[model samples]
Target: MSSTSSTVLRAEHIWLDGKLMKWDEGNVHVMTHALHYGLGVFEGIRAYKTHDGRLAVFRLREHIRRLLDSAHIIMLQIPYSEDELVEATVDLLRKQKQQFANGAYLRPVAFMGDGAMGLGAVNPTRVGITAWDWGAYLGDKGIKEGIRAKVSSFTRNHVNVNMVRGKITGQYVNSILAKREAVLAGYDEAILLDISGFVAEASGENIFLVNKKGVIKTPPLSSPVLDGITRDTVLKLLRDAGHTTIEEVTVTRDALYIANEVFFTGTAAEITPVREVDNRQIGDGKPGPISKYVQDTYFRVVRGQEARYADWLTYV
Candidate 1:
């Protein structure tokens, strides 16, 4: 990932509703239902500049589908179809080609517009897509040298209280608080546990651990964890790379402390290795060999260096 700060780099235009508009012109009213009630769904996607000098989005369709699925789960109807949203994303990226020459992070959000203010109000659903230049989410140093994390006092949302399947905007409050708690406590990130006290995930990423015998384990989706796209990709990559002892099961805090390696996987964090948890050193306090391999392969596949996963990329 780029070493630059992860600030949003302004672009020429943004896709709003059904058309491209000036970035600054794309605005939402303060009275928007989603703004007040948190009735919105969104997705995070990345476009990469390939080794051959082509620009492509990683798993574009999958991300879009997930966005739509999230909306459906929240009962927020998006006005556009899947194909329409996909084209709009490609169009927005094409228009911002010069500004995001290095690649960009794409955010597609669907929310309720200004209308009835009641909690059960049925409002017009509005959609927007924005692309901007962003760098390593956990910082470049943390990615390379590994990071310190704390098991958050905050528990992951219960599946009954919050729709775990949906990436709803309001649902992130839990993550924000946990992340803030960790950062304020002098840690690099936060790891949330399920209500049952099993390891769930990081603030915004999925968690994985490698045991002493080379067995890899992660909390099952049955836990209050998001079905992360990067988590799936890493699992496939690791298996193909001959690390076949992967399992999806409940994990404890002690399990992470005693693991040979621990790492985070997500669209933003990518494959960030966890070197310490609760101040306990992890595997020599460095990015482990397996974590490095996964990170290296993930970057290669995203940058179009690997041809086997070519189908996963959508050229812009």
Candidate 2:
């Protein structure tokens, strides 16, 4: 496999359940309850190489807290404690430190294992953690030149149908459909709207709009959007830096077209600018100044250069 491929497929060990096992042994039966019913919750976390040459994960505890929240939302009980999972994640990162020198993406998933079938399927929860090197999710070029996004036909799931607060495994099927549609339509990513027609978020990232007045606006948590950890970090950072960040804003599709700037936030996408949406150019068709500021600041904080946020990092 190419060195830069996301799927390395060769890891020393995988933290499964409560023990580390060979990557080849990280197996699940075809009839696993989660596999059949999609009763799993997962988190995407990243560890970065600090300026001082140490490796640390950003917002590690916060991510774990969210993971637990996701699990609670689905009534799945993880077999391990948060402290144990955090320790396992740090240990896993240390074990793969050599291959993931460029930094790594950690996927920690908790799901229902093999057990009862049908509507009454009840099973013990299984947890697994995998670490691998990952570069910018939207590609370096997409980060620099900005990405093209299409408003998807797929509507965000109704809160009554799917709990928007939890990162349920099956909930991503909608994202998959929307993303595939956008990619096939020749766009970089897809933007989903709420059932009521107001703007929601991108396929795998949270959306942000910068109005001409220079205020930053994003869809509220009530808008059926995932409460993205990265989104929270950015808002906190902006507020700390004396910038106005607004939430619970109802942004229409046409509002995006005339916005001064637009961007997406998530652990994977970070802070990527949206240069155009539906062929409407955004602010000279480039990464806007505010977007650049947030991106640079985020990188610095993640890399341990910003001491004010140093407590956010967990060293491996």
Candidate 3:
């Protein structure tokens, strides 16, 4: 991580209305309608600097599609098409002179165009793509370090009320509050429960547990959890790599105390091992084997080692 190495790796490459801006220099309006109200859709996409020096984005099409789908759900009409998002990403990478030998991270956001708010001011949606050098979202706190997570006292917004499937701006208020509560409670993060008292997600990431039989289980999207792109990828990776995974509807507070192991996933956090849930140790209190497998295989797929998932990447 030398200064030159840092410069060579993970420099700011962001897009604003087809124009490239320095990551720090990127700006938006203070009065933007979406800023005031969660009226826009966004995606957290990742690209890695591969061993071959190729910068490959993981699940480009799928992530953009999700962003577009989110936009459509909110009735926001982005001026660009799916192809345009992909093209803008490519052109931005080339202009930034990004090193293709390694993969990098990517983010694309589509929001209502700048204006004061009226409830129905979404006919003109503005879209932008931004990317930078980002590492695992587990933060500087490693999974082995074992962070604590508090079960949020505040419940997540119901799908009936907030349309939880879409990645809207306001949806994160629940996340922010839960995270803040965890920090105040002297824990690393928070786990949010859906309205029905089922475990929906751990703050921004999805949750998984190992049953007494050593089977992997995760909550289905039928719960309040937004369909995470990484969660989807891991489900495919585990199954393809020959592991049995189950989607269970069970969400008892007791389930946390009886699990062999538990972990969380997201674009930012990647595969994070949860050693403790609510102060209870998870399976002798260490990152589990299955969690490690998911982490190892996921980075491989993102880095383009797994040809089976290569379609998920866009090599630049």
Candidate 4:
């Protein structure tokens, strides 16, 4: 079977509500409130294979906490507790044999269920957790050789327009539209601008720029970007490696064309270098030295090679 098809077939079961069942058995009604109104919250998490031949979930508690926070922001009352969800994730990972062998992606979602039909209709919330072996969010080639991006014409949603802090299901429509635009325009990804034309982020990843001074800079949380867990990990790793990391730095679109190197961070994207933006080559048109350093360090940390960050891993 093709690799993509094989990956899709790998997950035989999923954790629904509080029980493990056949993947096909997990279903939702057609009139699900969240489906109609986009009133749901979710989290994207990954488990990794450590160098010592052990399976571990990176930053499990933090991801679970964020999931709870997102649900709270959207007024979706998750029936299960944080500890319950964490245990469910571990249990689900343990049940999936492929995950134990090669790591996997875990998705935990809680949304309003089918009940009332209006905008103000109150309904019970439903939860589900599923996982499957998956590869890089951007193509693997992009990870090794770097990717090309364009400044998207679409502006990111202002904070007032949506709760930027929450991973609301509906908020991703903006990203979807921008990603489609980038793909149609022959770019690997899109760099969205905040309402004010300041650098925000890629469709699903956080953007970072490294200048000649060897300093790392990314948009502040106040910008129209998700406060990514991987973004936090990268900044911490950079500073721990003796590089200065700056946040909330306003980066103009023109600044990207002149950056020594540009990269993106997220649970899926990891650390992907941007070789070009809007036809402008960053530095020498290769992954910058600082980008490589951070990417290398991040890979090691996630794989349990970095002893100092061992606490970040939760073994299965």
Candidate 5:
């Protein structure tokens, strides 16, 4: 196994195929079925360094449950129960305390191993869990000062064509294309529209817009958006903060242009405000009051400052 580097930090150990292994030794066969067919499901979870100096994973159980649900959706049965997987994640983190001293990002994935080589192939299932220190995915500046986004020429997957509810590994090709297009075109992020021209979501994040009327709106599950955990947390936070006008409704692209504020949410992006869409400045081209409030509150809740949301944290 190779030693860690400044640009690339490897966990001391990783959980693979039901056991812990050295990080460099956790390799799969070259002909792994999922590598060719993209038949897999996964989840992105985060652990936070609490205010009192403890490490806690945010919504760990919920993320594990969703991973199982995604596997079920694609008919790929994971070998372990949700509780077992959760324990494995905790154990993995425990073994990497120094590496993940500040916080960590966990990826739990289940996929098909090498076997038959066709679309209808049935192969053995393999599960792996990896954790590593990570920072703001969209860049720290993007999270604080807000980011610029463009409505991608690529459309979101139609409901029947791809399973929108499942975080399937193969299904993210659409997101990759959109994200690359945006980056190549000099934009920070991409916003994809649904088939019917309704605003869907960012490449890998759920979107929320605050309109001129102080109403917060996001695309419903009926739309082609993912059921993002961070999106759910933000909704709950908004309601608990006594904002009564939160609504899950169909939104058009033009609505984003006219919105007083826009933002993206996900395990990776967290609460990232969108300062501009296609060169049009959003609310004076700065993070709006509501966006900043939600971002601040989210960080606090994740880091264990909000006692009311303690149930959402699982200590490592």
Candidate 6:
């Protein structure tokens, strides 16, 4: 749970209102509306070092679009345009990667820095950008053994009441709680369903299911899943490989038990396999072939190896 050290960490980087500070140095009002009432949005973007010692980020354009979309859902006006945000990320990573000479992680947030107690004040919009080393969020299982998850007793919130399309701060209270419950229950993570019991996502990651017939399936938008950048990458890779992709509403507490392969995808989770759900072993309880392929293709694409997906990265 400790953070990366300053010896390998870059303290100053670009952010608006425009000043660079240590990653842990900052002051936001404790009564900030986003903290009290969940009125802000954010994105997690990662920069990976290629085998060539150069660094790149996956899907720079798409992540910025989703960040802006999430901010719009809450009416938070970002001070920067999508292109500006991309440039900021590239710049910050370039600075950190130069000193650290390795991959770094970025957290770019758009939030209401100020809001009235009655929730009726003009939101003061701000962006806080930070970058440092991110060793791993899910560790080696991210591609090796894969992760094992549980069906959370908790369910994802309805989009009608809470915006599920973007990374909203308050919505993560739900994710944090569910993931905590699963960890205590002896699993690596939690998989939540839509209010209707349709498979939605695993805490912060998007879930994918593989059927016995070698078919790839995932819970589509009807299930209120986030349009994850990594999830889309795997989907596109599967399609380009001539595999049929089923992005429809799917629900089966039983399906997790039978899924020939199951995995989760996100900037944090990357491509993680799920070997079990609620103690039921998935496909002999191991990372399966489909999840492995997705991991291999995604890894190459992200690290600047595959030219076909070059448009997805922003080299720093």
Q: What is the lDDT of every predicted structure here?
A: 0.91, 0.89, 0.76, 0.87, 0.92, 0.78
* Candidate 1 per-residue C-alpha lDDT over 233-255 given as tens digits, one digit per residue, 9 for 90 to 100: 99999989888799999999999
Compared with the true structure, what per-residue lDDT tens digits does model 2 show for residues 122-169?
788999999866777877888888999999999998889979999889
Which residues of candidate 2, in runs, are more than 4 Å off? Answer: 1-10, 245-247
Question: How many clashes in each candidate?
Answer: 0, 0, 16, 0, 0, 2
Show the lowest summed lDDT stretch of 10 residues, model 4: 1-10
TM-score of each: 0.97, 0.96, 0.90, 0.96, 0.97, 0.92
What alpha-carbon RMSD in Å does predicted model 5 have with respect to the real structure?
Answer: 3.1
Model 6 TM-score is: 0.92
- Tens digit of lDDT per residue, candidate 3, span 155-189? 98887987778888778888888887787877777
Model 5: per-residue lDDT, tens digit, 2-92? 0111243568899998899999999999999999989999999999999999899999999999999999999997889999999999999
Give candidate 5's whole-model lDDT: 0.92
Q: Arrange candidates by TM-score, descending.
A: 1, 5, 2, 4, 6, 3
Which residue ranges in model 4 land beyond 4 Å of their true spot? 1-10, 98-100, 245-247
Q: Assess candidate 3 and give its TM-score to the true structure.
A: 0.90
Better of 3 and 6 by lDDT: 6
**C-alpha lDDT of candidate 1 relative to the true structure:** 0.91
Question: Candidate 4 overall Cα lDDT vs. reference?
Answer: 0.87
What's the best-to-worst order under lDDT? Answer: 5, 1, 2, 4, 6, 3
lDDT of 4 at 23: 90
